[model samples]
Target: MALLREREWYAISLRPQGQHRRLRDAVTRAGGHLLALSPLRIVALDGADARSRLRDALAASRCVFTSPNAVTCAARLQALTTSRTIAVGAGTAAALRRHGIANAIAPDRMDSEGVLDLAELQAVAGQRIGLVSGEGGRGLIERSLRERGADVVRANVYRRDVAKFSPTALKRFDALPAATALFVTSAEALDAALGQLDGERRAKLLAFPTVVASERLREACVRSGFGRIVVAASAQPTDLVQAATTLV
Candidate 1:
């Protein structure tokens, strides 16, 4: 009788806390295990100043959301309204639709450069653009819009903090299978996740086949010493999981 090949796969998730359910479920359905290594925690900023900035963003001629977290946090502060709405990616656009902002559109490339490539943004000589996002990211979008002569107002609705991992989490990571793949989407999350690891563990992780969300992230993985890298179709949970499963 011929021996059967084993088909178990493992993927390390570096998404933010409370954002791993869909990816976990997808990995489970693919007959694989998902190890949570959430390196970032999202904190919603709903203070008076945050609310006022959100109001200004909503009142602008064009409003742009940088992430799903931005959409959710902005929705919590107040209603999302604008003449035209743009999301950095399809995921953010979906989040906006879930919050009843159905007219939001996203670029095909799903990045700062992609957002800037949109034709709608090309002719903004004297337009007010509101950027709804987390704290201290997506500066490229703001800068480019301003260079295009658009008055860009940034409304920071959330902040990303480095998450603390427990001892058990480190132990679990140490015990991960040799054939496991690393899934990295956000460059910030990647930096935070690797920063929390000791040298040995970090080197071991860099040796794994990494699946990144974009070419930019692939370059980041290369610079971070990841030996092998693969770019996923998009940052969507299903896409990332699908790409990871192919590695092992």
Candidate 2:
């Protein structure tokens, strides 16, 4: 936490949800400036069309949830007959428990590749698997499971939509102190930030350092001509703080 205090400014790419207040406090206590990028909205998949497909996937041999939003959506999809539930991370697993669903497993690492690396899934030949996540996420999990002879069915439970900029929205970035490091959790979030910025605001942001969670997002930033893009070792907040400290 002390390390994070060394930075003059920061841009937090968390959606404008109720949970962001805690993160905002953390940044302020660390003595870093924080600009809240528009929150990503989660739309549930509760329509009749989606319910039928989700029912089919729920009958699979096992179920996988890619995010907490997915777990919440899956819980609403009515009765599920899968024998096991695998979550991409501890957070997602807890979300499942919140919805009264048990038998959830979280991988040691919190990513699609890590989930596939689990011993339980490695030999899942001829098994049927259901993947629950938001629409249009990375396809690694689905592709890998299919290659391993598992019939993978993806159930999209939600869609992310960035918040529209209000009159006071730009002030968040404008008030930020100089030399702030922007933290981006995903490539999609980064794209939304860029799209939200005006031409001048975009140039100003390009001058600040950026911390991304994955190599893929870092590469995207580089290709977009961002000045400095640092990839966080992991998605955890501690890892992000360490990376920010290094740059600061």
- The model with the greatest TM-score is 1
For candidate 2, give the lDDT of residue 193. 71
| Candidate 1 regions with alpha-carbon error over 4 angstroms | 1-6
TM-score of 1: 0.95
The global C-alpha lDDT for each of the candidates, from Candidate 1 onward, is 0.88, 0.73
Candidate 1: residue 178 lDDT (0-100): 79
TM-score on alpha carbons, each prediction: 0.95, 0.85
lDDT of each residue in 79-118, candidate 2, tens digit only: 5456688988767877888876677888877777778888
Q: How well is each residue in 4-59 modelled by candidate 1, as lDDT tens digits?
A: 12677788899898898988887777777888888999999979999998899888
Model 2: how far residue 40 lies from native, Å: 3.5
For model 2 the local lDDT of residue 129 reads 88
Prediction 2 global C-alpha lDDT? 0.73
Q: What is the lDDT of residue 47 in candidate 2?
A: 84
> CA shift at 23, candidate 1, in angstroms?
1.0
Clashing pairs in model 1, backbone N/Cα/C closer than 3 A = none
